[model samples]
Target: MSDQLFGSWMDKRDSNWVVFAYFDWIYSSGMFIQMLECLSKRWGFGTDDVDCRFPDNNSFDVDDHFSGVEFSYGLMYDPDVVIVSDEEFGRYLDMACFKYIERTPGSAEYVRSMLSRNEPGNG
Candidate 1:
C-alpha cells in the first residue's frame, strides 16, 4: 500500500483524490468486483459510478497471459469538515481491505498509512 503500490496511478482532481489499484493476472475478476462493491458501500455511491474493464481474447496480449483488473475511486470527503474527518476516511480504507478484500492482518494498516501520507500537502 505504499505510493509505489499504485505507482503512477494516483492523482488529485478538484479537491478529490483519485486512487487506482490494479491486480494482475493472478487475481480473479471476482476480486475486482468485490472491491467495487466495497467502494460503493463505503462511499454510498452505486457501482454505476465505477468503471471496470478487463482484457479479452480480442485485446492485446501480454507476456503474463493474465487479464489485469483496475479499480479506481475518487475520495471526495473533506477531512477538515465536521461531517467527515481524516480518521473516517482512513477507517473506510481499512474496513474495505479487511472486510471486503479479506486481506491479511496489517494490510489495512499499510493502506491507511499510505493514504495518510498521500493526502494533499501531506507528502
Candidate 2:
C-alpha cells in the first residue's frame, strides 16, 4: 500500500496464531500476488494467502483496527501439522513484514500509532 504493509509486534512471541496487520492504501494486485507466492514458500505453503496474525496479549484480544491475516485452510482453532507453537507465527510475520514493509520492520510504534487514533470520542 503506502510503501508499508506490516504486522506490528513488540516480541515474536507476543502473538502466536495472529497477525496484527498495519497497512497503507496502494493496493497492487500484481505485487500482492507475487508476494503471496514468494511468502508461501517461506511459510510452508505451496500456494495460498499468508494472512498471518499475532495476538497483542495472552488474553487473545482481537484488535479492532485490523482483522489481521486470513488462513486458506480456515481459522486456527488448534495448532496442527501446519503450525506448532513457538517461533512459527513470529517467523512468518517477520518474513512478511520484511518482504512487504522493510528490513527488520514492525514494532510497537506501529501498533501504538493505531491505538492513538482509536480515541474515546473518535469513531
Candidate 3:
C-alpha cells in the first residue's frame, strides 16, 4: 500500500508496473525501465522522432512525440514525468507500458498493431 502510493517499487524490484486500469498484472519485478521505454515509444503520435527534456528535476526525459509535443501540451514544455495527458493517449500508453512488462513485448505489440488496423477509425 505504501509502496504503491509512494513509488518505492522503483528502488527495489518489489512490485509490477501497473499503471491505471488498462492491464493485467505484469510479472514486472520492477520493470520500470521498460515502462519508460514503452511510454516514450507509444505516446499516441510517434513519428519515429525523439527529443530531450531538461526539467528542474535532475531527471532526463525522452519520447517519440517530438513532432507535435508542443501542440499536444499547448506549450513547449517537456515534462519529466507526464502526469498530465489526455484520455486516449493515457489509455493507449498505459496498455503499451503494461505489455512491455510482460515477457513478450514484440509479439504483444504485433497483436496491438493488427488490432489497430481493424479498429473503426483506421479504415
Candidate 4:
C-alpha cells in the first residue's frame, strides 16, 4: 500500500504499525496463545478469565470473539517472535492478520489491491 494510504489508514484507528507488526510476528511464529493472552490482558479481560486453552505452548483455543483482534492490544509495547508448527493454522493466522489490516481505515482498497496483485486467480 502507498504511504499516503497507509498514513490515512493509521489516522482512523487508535492503533500503531508497531502493534500490527507484532501481530504479524506472533501469528507467523504460531505463538498465538501468548498473543491472545497479551491482547486479552490489554483489552481489560485480564480479570475476566476467559477459557483460553494453550495447546503445547504454541496455539491457543480462541473462540470466535478472540480470533482476529490481537492487533489492538494496548500493553504490549514491543514485538516478540512466536514458534509455529501447523502450516494450515499459520496460513489462517496470516489471513486473519490481512483481514485486520484491511479493516483499518483507508486500507481496504489497498489491501484488496495487494491481494489481487499477489493472487490474481483468487482475486
Report the lDDT tens digits of candidate 1 across residue range 4-62: 22234334442323322232211223343344344333322223233333324554666
Sorted by lDDT, highest first, which candidate order results?
4, 1, 2, 3
Flag regions of model 4 displaced more than 4 Å.
1-15, 43-123
Model 3 per-residue lDDT tens digits across residues 3-98: 122233233232222122112211223433433444344323212122212122332545323332221211234511222333444454445445
Tens digit per residue, CA lDDT, model 2, 27-94 = 12234433333333332222233333322334444441232333322223442113223344434544
Which of the two candidates, 1 or 4, achieves a greater TM-score against the reference? 4
Q: By lDDT, is 2 or 4 better?
A: 4
- Model 1 alpha-carbon miss at residue 76, Å: 16
Candidate 1 local Cα displacement, residue 31, angstroms: 9.1
Clashing pairs for predicted structure model 2, backbone only: 18-53, 18-54, 19-52, 19-53, 19-54, 51-69
Q: What is the TM-score of each candidate against the true structure?
A: 0.24, 0.24, 0.22, 0.24
Alpha-carbon RMSD to native, per candidate = 15.5, 12.7, 13.7, 13.4
Question: What local lDDT score does residue 39 receive in model 2, on the 0 to 100 scale?
Answer: 35
**Tens digits of per-residue lDDT for model 4, 1-123:** 332212322233433443344444444444444444343232221111111111332336333233322323223444322223233233434464365465454655544443343232431
- What lDDT would each prediction earn against the true structure? 0.35, 0.34, 0.34, 0.36
Candidate 3 displacement at residue 62 in angstroms: 21
The collision pairs in model 3 are none
